[model samples]
Target: MNVLSLRNVTKTYQNHTAVNNISFDVPQGSIFGLLGPNGAGKTSLIRMITMITGVDQGEITLNGKRLNPDMILDIGYLPEERGLYKKMKVGEQLMYLAQLRGLTKQDAKRDIKEWLEKFEASTWWNKNIEELSKGMQQKIQFIATVIHKPKLLILDEPFTGLDPLNTNLIKEEIFKLNENGASIIFSTHRMEQVEEICKDIVLINNGELMLEGEMNAVKQKFKENKYSIEFDGMLPAHLKSDSFSVVEDTQKGLVIQVKPGHDSNEFLQSLIQEGIHINSFQEILPSLNDIFIKNVNNKI
Candidate 1:
């Protein structure tokens, strides 16, 4: 079932439409990527989902019901702009935020302690937010965001200030949360990270829905039938055929594009007939980064 659904949702400001007739579903327990280029209305859509702003047209639902103010407690949002109070102590800040999300004082304290220990941040509890580094502060904010154990998490540029170690730490926690029945909407410009973690994705551009589907399926839809073939010997200098064209010469292989009417098998058979010792042959699918660029440029 979908944990969140937007149907022809739109938001506008005077003469400008920030989100125009957008719609998509975020499945329960799935890591979904909400991606778009800057000025593409991603922030506007996020604000509507989080109830920070209302949609100008259409509907949004949570768990099959019309979205209401009460549903806000069920969502844990880590906005791209950090919102921690610099003068506040980490432990107290977390306790406060957790309580606001409907946790009891005692429950908040217990969960806070457990989370701090889990993040290897027990010693940081007593430190003021200003005393920690940017990365350290992010950890504190992350704990606060999840302390109430909300069912839906919306994280925007979550790894911005993190180091490699801390980035992995946060990533592992994200996976753990999704495994424990949380639905995540990960919004970011980092296509590589989305490629690694997201199973489904939706792309928006110029305030309109540009693409949406399972990650692998979307890549398959954009594939250009490019293949990489690794062989033991050098390619024939005069290698020529209407069935395929070599695009590049790699260290141990040549990247070739199979002609529209031909398949990989036909090309492989042609190479075999040419006496080339083949090591490996595989299709090279377009990366999410490449797809993102192409779609935003309206090349899809």
Candidate 2:
């Protein structure tokens, strides 16, 4: 089921188009990646979804209904740029944001305490936001965003300023939220996280959609029929065949690109004929980072 859908969405400035005739669907209870390079209209689209900016053309639907101001309560957003009252105490600031999201005082306090403890952040409650380090302040802001438990969570560069330990802590919570029925839209330059956490993705560049599909499907669609081989014997300097080409030599193995209409068995036979004792051979699948670079460059 789709929790959010955008149809022919476009956003424009006086003389510039920030988002141009784009469309995509985000499945409910799934972690979806919204990815692109800088100035790729990702931020513009996010602003429109969160109601910070209005769409110039087309429609956005949330939960099968046209989007409106009241629907803001159904979304929890953590922008790339952090915003919190520097002088406000951590607990006070969180409670205020929760209230704005329509949570009652008692429920807000319960959820805040639970989240603070879950993050190992209970001691930070009384400290003013200005007194905390950037990473510490990030924890407070994260707690505030989800305290009301909205159905849709949009996080942009959420791991900035976080150490690996804290990053893992937050990552675990993100999974837990999705498992419990929240849909997520994650935006980041960190391709590894997208590969690790997202079930599907939408890629954009230069105000246009570049790609969209399930994560595994996207990688499979771009597979190059390459293989990596580890052998016991030394590799010949100029190994070549009409059926295959040595793409590169690694520290422990050779990467081969199988020619069209040539199967792995034929490639392996060629290697064995040359006295290369193969220890291991595996098909190489393209990484998400590699695909991202390849597609963006091709579009350019």
Q: Please, what are the lDDT tens digits per residue for candidate 1 over residues 71-136?
A: 999999999987799899998899989999999999999999999999888998888899998888
Which pairs clash in model 2?
none
lDDT of 1 at 9: 99
| CA lDDT for candidate 2 | 0.92
lDDT of 2 at 294: 95
Would you list the C-alpha lDDT of every candidate in the order shown? 0.92, 0.92
By TM-score, who's the top model here?
A: 1
TM-scores for every candidate against the unseen true structure: 0.96, 0.93
- The sequence of per-residue lDDT tens digits that candidate 2 reaches over residues 211-247 is 9999989988999989999999886655566778889
Report the error of model 1 at residue 71, Å.
Answer: 0.7
